[model samples]
Target: MKTQVAIIGAGPAGMFLAHMLRTEGIDSVVLERRDRDYVEGRVRAGVLEQIAVDVMRKLGLADRLDREGLVHGGTNLSLDGEIFHIDMEKLTGGSTVTVYGQQEVMFDLFEAAGPRGVNIVWNADNVSLHGLDSDKPSVRWTEEGAQKELQCDFVVGCDGFHGVSRQSIPDTVLRNFERVYPFGWLGILADVPPCNDELIYANHERGFALASMRSPTRSRYYIQCALDDRLEDWSDDRVWDEVCLRLGPTAAAKVVRGPSFEKSIAPLRSFVAEPMRWGRLFLAGDAAHIVPPTGAKGLNLAVSDVTYLSEALVEHYRERSAAGLDNYSARALARVWKAERFSWWFTSITHRFPNMDGFDRRIQMAELDYIRGSENAQRVLAENYVGLPLD
Candidate 1:
């Protein structure tokens, strides 16, 4: 097969980029190691930044999102039991975030791909890139024990951190920066209403807890846990008890306990692979960077990466310009680093570090106290939380 671009992994980043390119009359094929059911079933980010929402709408994919997404103008923060609100909408001049799950976003993208003619190869095995340094780059993979090759002008790695895309770049050309947190997030999805209309991030004496939702009736909750904590150690009742204790009186009073359908623990990390582009291969989404879910920037950052990438590809095809392509890495990294800083800062202030001393705890509290008391601090938080502009 031959195409203009070969996109690895059919996750949000690759699928969204495929759709964007399709709308531009650009031809591309998406290769996935898993089926659609697996990709769409992955439990992921539940918040949509303004940029993501805009991209979905721009691609004519936000009909369901617009109808079902919960629009939040502000978010709540708790320093121990004292809860405070940050008016994000007012602080950011009417910018707001939508509570739409990443799973739902994938559903919309996949559903539209067929009618829109976005080609995808599912269950591709041993996917690898070849000749990325040359103008005629190609991708190879095995499908059902059959060998297949795709000749394309360029290859894009959206296959995520563990995938072969980033590793395809030479070790001498790549530099990595990473921080793996000592703790993980023990989360549960239950069929009950959320304790709060807007998300509440709590920093308690015990640990950090987040009260979030996938929908009005489906509550998603999480609390910090040991890095090696086992799922068997946490029963529904015990998890609820810990969540309530950490959330404190006000928010916990509204908490509704129910049977949890999904439960898992995810470790936290901040990672970035520099020079997103190497020769004819480009990287986007989890393939290039990862942010702790604290600030909900992972998927949004991917949207921004593809947004820049699609633009660069469009310029190359439409205007015959290499300038945008040359500048893609620097442009995407500028935004990626800012988001990395925000997610890191937010996690630091909200999560308990294993080595934190008395002074560290006190400083964390002081930062939260300052944000609660100062409009300037709230504005800064709101600006980064809603997401910075593409410029």
Candidate 2:
């Protein structure tokens, strides 16, 4: 097969790119190692920054999102059981975030793919890139015991962190920065009403806890845990008990206990692979960078990455300009690093390190207290939390 672009991975980045390219009259194919069911069912963060919501609407994919997604004008932060609200909308001149699950976004994208003529190859195996440094690049993968090759002008790798996209870049050309947190988050999804209308990030002596939701009726909650914690180590009752204790009495009073349908432990990490573009092969989403879920920037970052990428590609095709393409890395990284800093800062103050001394605890408290008392501090938090404007 031959096309203008061969996009690897049918995840958000790739699929979003495909739809964007299609709307621009560019031809592309998306290759994925998993089937649609598996891809759409994966659990991911539910927060959508303004940029993401705008992208969805621009692509004509926000009908359901507009109807179902919860828009939050503010968020709550808690320090040792005391909660304070940050008026994000008012602070940022009406900017807000939408609580729409990634799963729902994928479903909308995939559902619209066929009618919109976005081509995708599911269950593709051993996907690999070739001739990335050349003007013409190609991708190859195995499908149902058969070999296939796609020749394209450019190949985009949105396959994520563990996928082959990042690995395809030579070691000499890539520089990595990473921080793997000592703890993980024990998250659960239950069929119960959320305790709060807006999301809450909590800091307690025990650890950090997040009270979130996928919908009005489906609550999602998480608490920091040991890296080695197991599913068997936490029962529904125990999880609820710990969540309530950490979130404190005021919020916990509204918590509704129910059987959790999904539970998992995810290690926290901040990672970034520099120089997103490698010749004709470009990387986006988790393939390029990763932020801890503390600030809910992972998917939104991917959206921004591809948003820049798609614009670059459009300029190359429409205006015959390579300036955007050439500057893509530097431009995207500028914003990526800012988000990295915010996520790191947010996590640092909210989570408990293994060796944290009294001074460290006091410092965290002081920082929270400052934000609580100062409108300037709250505005800074609100600005970062709702996401910075795209450059």
Candidate 3:
């Protein structure tokens, strides 16, 4: 098979890029190592930035999201037995975040692209790229125990951080920046309603806790734990108690606990790879960078990457210009670094360090107090939380 673009993943970034290219009359195909069910069922962030929401609407993919998503104007931060709200809508001149799952976004992308003949090959095996730096680049993969090949004008690696795309680049050319935190988040998804109207992030002497939701009736919650902590270590009741104690009186008063249906522990990390592009093989989303989930920038950053790549390819095919593609890496990396900074800062402030001394705790207390009291601090938090406007 031959195509203009070969996207190596069926996740939101790769799938959305294929749709965008299609609307521009560019031909592309999507390849996935996993089936659609696995891809769509994976739990991820539910927050959508305004730009991402707008893009979905532009693609005629916002009907379900608009009807089901919960729009939040603000979030609460709890510290020292006090919880304060940061009104993102008011601080950011009317911008707010929509609580729509990443899986839902994938569903919309799939539905929109299906009738239009978006060729996505699921369960492709041994997917690898060849001659990316040369014209007539090709991708090779195994399907149903048979070897297959695809020639393309470009190959995009949206397969994520553990994907083959980034590793395909030569070690000498790829520079990596990474920080693995000393702790992890033990998260649970329950059938109970969320305790608060908005998300609550709590920092107390015990640890950090978060009360979030996938919907009004389905709550997702998390508590910080040691890096070596196992899922078996936490019981449903114990998790709820820990969350309530850390969140304090105001936010915990509304608690509605139930048996947790799913539980997992995710280690926190901030990582970035310099130059998101190598030859005709471009990296997007988690394949290029990863941010700790504290600020909810992971999925949004990937969308912005698609936003940039889509425009670049459009300019290339329509105007016969390569300027956008040429500048893609620098542009994406600039935004990537800012998000990394925010996530790193937010994670540091919210999570308890094992080695934190009394002085460090005092400083954290003061910083929390100042952020709650100062409009400037609130604005900073709000702007980053709602997302910086996509460049």
Across 67-155, the per-residue lDDT of candidate 1 in tens digits comes to 99999999999988789999999999999999999999999999999999999999999998999999999999999999999999989
Better of 1 and 3 by lDDT: 1
lDDT of each: 0.97, 0.95, 0.91
Judged by lDDT, which candidate is best? 1
Give per-residue CA lDDT, model 2, range 1-391, as digits (tens).
Answer: 8999999999999999999999999999999999999999999989999999999999999999999999999999999889999999999999999999999999999999999999999999999899999987899999999999999999999999999998999999999999999999999999999999999899999999999999999999999999999899899999999999999999999999999999999999999999998899888999999999999999999899999999999999999999999999998999999999999999999999999999999999999999999999999999999999998
For each candidate, what TM-score against the reference?
Answer: 1.00, 0.99, 0.99
Candidate 3 wrong stretches, greater than 4 Å: none
Which lDDT tens digits does candidate 3 get at residues 1-391?
9999999999988988988888888999899999989998888888898988998898778999999999999999999458899999999999999989888898888877779788899999999899999978999999999999999999999999899999999998999999999999999999998998899989999999998998989999999999898788789989999989998988778989899988999998999998899999899999999999998999999999999999999898889898999999999999989989999998888879999999999998888889999999999999998889876
Whole-structure CA lDDT of model 3: 0.91
Count of steric clashes across candidates, in order: 0, 0, 0
Ranking by lDDT: 1, 2, 3
The worst-scoring run of ten residues by lDDT in candidate 2 lies at 128-137
Residue 163 in candidate 3, Cα distance off native in Å: 0.5
TM-score ranking, best first? 1, 2, 3
